[model samples]
Every structure is written in structure tokens, then in C-alpha cells.
Target: MGSGSFSSVLKKPETTSFIILVLVMVGFTLANDRFLSPLNISNLLAFMPELGIIALGMTLLLTAGEFDLSVGAVFALTPVSTLLMVQNGGLSLELALVIAFAATFLVGALNGFLVTKVGISSFLVTLSMLLIVRGTTLVLTQGFPLNSWDGDNWLRTALAGSFYIGTVRIYASLIWFAALGLLALYVLNVAKVGNWITAIGSNRSAAVARGVPADKVKIWLFIATSMLAGLAGVISSLRIASASPVAGSQYELEVIAMVVVGGTALTGGRGTIIGTIIGVLMLRIIRNGIVLVGVPGLAFNIFVGVIILAMLVLHARFNKSSERK
Candidate 1:
């Protein structure tokens, strides 16, 4: 039993993700000597946080057997709304941010209400929301980029600027990514809500019968997911000094792919934020590596698609084998 338990632990998704990450790192390093250079590393880390932040939220939602396809829409919408408030509405930047977030929270609440109270399927509801939010963003921005951000603003610097650590530069977004990732890790592994999430995913009816407020818990998760996406959007817009109406287009697919690649079950009931981090890193490195090796940017998606398919197949097989044992 002791050996069996050890083996089971070793077979976990986090372990697999870690091993894959290491292997990919080694492969990339061998392919390009510049892969480990300080500039490349810094850039890679910098690029990860936006998607990483969104992926963290997706991890929680998926673990609870819920989906939020509208995250990308929320992401695009938040920055657009913030910029509009600042540029057209003549509001203070900070106040604009506050209002943007409040709006996103309402959007999340609507998603939660429709799914939890109205009995709409999360997938369908969020999909419709994705279209609605994206459409609103396009109509508001008139399909143009909003470039009214002040780079000198303290808030902008704190949210998207770079800091130096000796000779290496680190992005503030990366700091946010690490801080949020650790916080998510703690919440998913140590908090009582984590148990509730898993219970609801595993057996919603059973969990409800056991006195868990399944609807409330799920609604809260939906809200948290949208808020995270909103924050990511703001950070991204600030980083670029612009908010494009088309920003975060197809991000829903990418975020879901990241969560699924991290070994979170598509049907939910099992996941780890730490594993998702590994998954994020692995995919990011692969994408970066492909570009470094002279692959066309358009081909990047093809590789990502192939990798996700392979991982899913392997993950399913592993589960089947474990069950047989």
C-alpha cells in the first residue's frame, strides 16, 4: 500500500506537467543557445502574465465544473471601457479603472445568475455572453485602438512597467503573475472553498444534499473568473499603451487550452493551480521556441493544437490505466 500510494502520487497531473516542462526546457535550450539568455527569458516571462492571469481563473472555474467562454470578451471589454471612460468620459484614470471593474463584476454576476438561477448551461450561456460582450466592445471602440494611456502615470508603471534586479529586468506583470499564481495555489489546495469546488464538480446533487451551497459557490467562482480576466485586460492595455477592440480575440480558446493542457479534467472534479502554471510555462516556451527556430508565426497555433491533442490522449490513457490498477 505504501508503494502504491507513492506511485499514485507520482502519476499526478502536477508531476506530469513538471516533467514535461523540464523536457521542453531542455529541448529548447538545445535548439537555440539564445533560449536561456537574459533578454529572452525576461521577454518570455513578460509575455506570460496576461494569459497566465486568465488561466488561473480558468483553473478554478474548470475545477468546479464550470466554463467561462466570455472571459476573452470581458478581457477585451474592460480595457476598452477603462480607456473610454478616461478619454471620452473625462474621468480620472483610477476612477475609470474602478468603474470598469465594477462593470465586469456585474457581467460576471449576470453570467452566474443565468447559469445558476435560470438553469442555463454554463457553456452555452458563456458562449452567448462572449458574442454579446465582444460586440459591445466593437461598437463602443468603432474597431479602433484606444491609445490614450499615460506611460508616466504611477498606476500604469506599477501595473505594466519593468524593474531591474541587478542586470536582469523583470516586468511588473510577471510579478503580478507570480503573486496571483501563488495565491491561487493556496486557495485551491488549502481553502475550504477548494473542497466545495471539487465536491460540486464530482457530484453536484450529492454536494448540495451534504449542505454545500453549490449555487453560491459557483456564482462566486464565476465572479472571480471575470474579475481576473478584467485585471488581465487592464494590465495588457497598460503594457501596450493601447486598448484594441480586437484585443483578446480567440483568448477564450487559448485559456481553455491552457487549462486542459494542465491536466485539469474537461468534465471537472479534479485540477491543480500549480499544474496549470507548469502547463502555462510549457506552452509559452514551446511557442517562443518555435519562433526562435525560424518558424512562421502563423504556424504557432498548429503546434499548440497538436501538443494539446497529444496531451489529452496521454492524460486519458493514464487515467484508464490507473483505474484498471
Candidate 2:
């Protein structure tokens, strides 16, 4: 490749992450031939989209200098509420969906209001929201798993159904994830709103002074973040044909880790949808690989720590090089 081409490739934020993903895949495959087996690959793809959808929303929040810790709980809350309404309240599925998502939207709006209007820290506000939402879900469902779908519905199928191609499975959730990811990429890189978000994260007061509706944009992003989480939750419940009140209980931290490891700054002002995708895949692959290779699942986070550290170094080097040029 020409020097210019090489430089351009290196400058792309996801390059190192993609390289690491390939390395991890190869390493795991070498360790256990099953890593690349059709069963394992199908399983990985089936489960990945749940987290992938959440990570896309997180990328936007991080890029805008904000985050919603309540997403994990929202993931559970939305679907559980929808299913309950359908089963117990005798509501139509479509109406149940609208009501459930609207409730989730209200949660997001309240979170934004507390942070941006009430002068509370986003972290504390969202953390509190997490607990509140989780508690509400538990109380509503009495800690039981919601009933599964017995009849076929196009919406449910579109959200979570799967079909096999020979021995390989293709899931509708994966399709949803990819479609949303492409949309997110456009929003973050090609849209004017994206620039406004970046500006707010880079310097909030300055962005406000420059005529960006910083607070309003943040509120909308918060809503978007929660809606994405809810969608993921709904998809997840449909995939298993049941919604657990405790589903996605730990997803908040995992999504944050994926975003950070994918090259998004924890403190915000920068992020990449493609990098988040790589991060999500890398983490899931490592998690799957560990279990297959006889490593205890408890040690999974150890690998995550090491990978995060390595990514930090890699990103720093690339950034330094870019600055020099």
C-alpha cells in the first residue's frame, strides 16, 4: 500500500480493535477447534445482537458526554411490562408495545430532567434510576419470568426469531442490530446532530455558547439510549420466549466496558460505532472462548481488564502518531 493509504488505515479508529478481534478468534480457534464450529458460531451470533444494540446507544451517549446506567434495568422493564400487559391486562400486542416503550421513554426523560435540570450528576441520577427500575420490575412480576409467546407474530419474529441455513443459524436480532448500527454510524458521523453531540462532549459551555441546544440534545439522547436498551430487552425476551425480571441485570457495566474498550473515551467527547461493534464482538468472543477452553467464567473479567489495558496503549500510540503528523 502507498504511505498515504497506510496512514489512512492506521488512522481508522477500529483498525487495532479489528486486528485484536481476529487475533482472539485465531487464538481461541487454535486452543479449541470448537471455537469455529457451526454450533458455537451460531450461538455467538444469536446472543451477540442483544448487547450490540445496547452498545450502539451507549456510543452516542459517550460521544455526547453522558450515559444512562439505568439501561440494563430498562432492558428488563420494557419487555416485562409489555408482556404483562398483553397477558394480564388483555391488551393487544401492539398497544402493549406502545405503552411499554412510552413508559421507558418517561424513565429516560426523568433521568435527563434530574441530570440536566435538577443539577444532579448524571452518574448518580442514572444509578438511582437503575435501582428504581429494577425494583419496580421485581415488584410487578414478583420476581417471576414472564410467559413466552405461543403464537407467531411478525413483530416478535422480526425482533428475535431465528432460522437455520443448513447448520448455521441466522437471527432477526442480528439483522436489527446491524440495521441500527448503520443508522447510528450515520447519526454520529454524517449528521449535523452528531457534530452537535461531539461539541457538547468536547466542551458543554462552549457548545451552548456556540448556539447548540446542549441540554435539549442531551435529553433526547438520554431518551434514545433508554429506547435502545428497551428494544434490546424486548428482543432478548422474545429470543428466549420469556422475559425474566432479572434479565440484563449486569448489562450496564458490560456495555460501558464494551464502549470504553472499543476506543470511546470514558469521559466522553469521542467514540466510533464500528469500534463499539468490534469491542462488543471481542468481549463476547473472549467470554465464549474462555468457557470452551476450560477457563472458569469467573475469570472472564480478568481477560477484559488485560484487553482494556492493551487497547489503551494501542489507542495512545495511534493518537500520538496522528498528532505528530
Candidate 3:
């Protein structure tokens, strides 16, 4: 494709998301004047980073034609691992954090290895890993919340504290999210490895025939996804000052929804960091708006289901139109 065509195709996905974001902002603002207030807006933005980080990684994996259903479990375990290290394993906070992240990365690598090397379906492999990790956390913690590290001031400040911009709180994790988003964007758009990733996701068999190391690419993507989830978990744990085995129980769904809504194809080989960010923000705002409008918390799940269904329909129609053209 020529550069002009390529740029146009790239811009199309973001345009849809940008429009959705604008509509969401307008709808929420009309519903509640407080929605546009600096405090509420800042709070909304604050929740974006952790999910944004996970979604960024998940976007890459999904673009490569794989799914990581184990992310939420991995997320839950990271903080559990950190708590274990600090309390039961007698490690310092810093060392515990390192081990926590490393362990999550290793888990991700294991998922990748199983899917690529053992020739298992990515869905099945990560699904099994999800149960395994969750079960292990339960057995280790005996179904109780891990609460021994509440006094780590330095760790708390570094991982969970916010910087203020004239009274608006910008979280440390938000900074990490921005940095990682830029890095992921660069790797996807400007690097040779990004091409390989797109090739592998677009057509694994063709990628292999072209001498691309498909397995290696997949393994690394899995690890990267896991590391992002782990980091998010660690930050969340610090912010909450405790680790609960069930903390991230449904987070995988949220992240997947964010990616899909952001226009990342479930079939892979198509997505963008900017779209994922917009998708994440849109979902967050919808959830927040539900609360602001006094919708029952339980009813939000129904709303989410409806939103996902609508997006899927739109995606199918969009793809069909593109193919016809």
C-alpha cells in the first residue's frame, strides 16, 4: 500500500474511538454537571492508568491473534506474591516488589511457552493458568486478605502516591502508563520487531514461512502482557495497602472490553495504543456515569453487556463494509 493509503487506514480506527469519546463526555456532562468538574475528571483519569497499562499489553497480544485470560489472576497474584515476600518470606519491600514483577513475567512466559511450544490453544492455556494461579493464591493465603505490609511508607510513596498539579492528583502509575504507551506505540509503528509482530498476528503460517520466529514473538508478547498486569497489581496493592486474592477477579473482562471497544480486533493483527486508551477512558466514564446517575451497581454489569454487544455488532458491520469496498 502507498503511504497515503496506509496512513488513512491507520487513522480510521482512531477516528471512531475519538468520536465515541466525545459523545461519552457530552452525555456524561449533560447528565451530571459534576462529571466535568476537575475533581471528578481527575479521579476518572486516575483509574485509567492501571487498566490502561494492562489494556496496552493486551492490545498487543490480541493484535498478535492471542488472548491472555489469565491477566486478572496474574494481577491478583502479584500483590499476593509481594505481600508474601515482605511478610512471610522476610524480604525487604524493594526486593519483594522486584520478585513480584519477575514472578508475573515468568508466569506470562510460561503461558506463551505452553501455547507456542506445546501447540495448545492460547485461550485454553491461559484459562488453565488463570485457575492455577487463583487456586495457588487461595491455598497460600488460606482465603484471607494479605495485610502485613501496611507500614511501608517508601514503597507506598513510590508506587501509589500522586503528584499534584495545582490540587489535581496525577498518580505515579499514570506516568508509567504514558511512558509504556509511547514505548509500545514506537515498537508497534517504528521498529522491525513491530512488523514481525503484525506479520505473526496477521498470518502465523505465513510469518513462519517468511522466517519470522512466531513462537518467540508470542512468548515475548505474553511476558510483556503479564509484566504490565503484574506492575498494575503491585501498584494497586500499594494503593489499597493490602492484597486480596479476589481483588482482580473480573478485571480481565474489563481489559478485554476496553481493547475490543477501542477497535482492536479479537482475531488480531489490527489495533492501536491510542484507540485502546480511548476505549479505556470510555468504559471508565460509562461506569462513572452510571454511578453519577444513581444506577444500581448491579445494573452496571447489564449495561456493560449491552455495550459490548453493540460494539461487536458495529465491528462486524465495519469489517464487512471494508471488505465490500
* Top-lDDT candidate index: 2
Q: What local distance difference test score does each model get?
A: 0.88, 0.90, 0.85
Report lDDT (Cα) of residue 65, candidate 2: 91
Q: Mind sharing the TM-score for model 3?
A: 0.93
For each of the candidates, the C-alpha root-mean-square deviation to the true structure, in angstroms, is 1.6, 1.9, 2.4
**What is the per-residue lDDT of model 2 for residues 171-228, given as tens digits with 9 covering 90 to 100?**
9999899999999999999999999988999899999998999889988999999999
> How do the residues 187-230 of candidate 1 rate in per-residue lDDT, one tens digit apiece?
88898988889889878999999999999999998999999999
Q: Model 3 Cα displacement at 14 (Å)?
A: 2.0
Check candidate 2 and list the clashing pairs: none
TM-score of 2: 0.95
Q: Per-residue alpha-carbon lDDT of model 3 for 28-123, expressed as tens digits? A: 789889987779878986788888889999999998899899999888899898888888988888888787788888899999999999999998
How many clashes in each structure?
0, 0, 1
Please say which candidate is ahead in lDDT: 2 or 3: 2
Model 1 ranges off by over 4 Å: 1-5
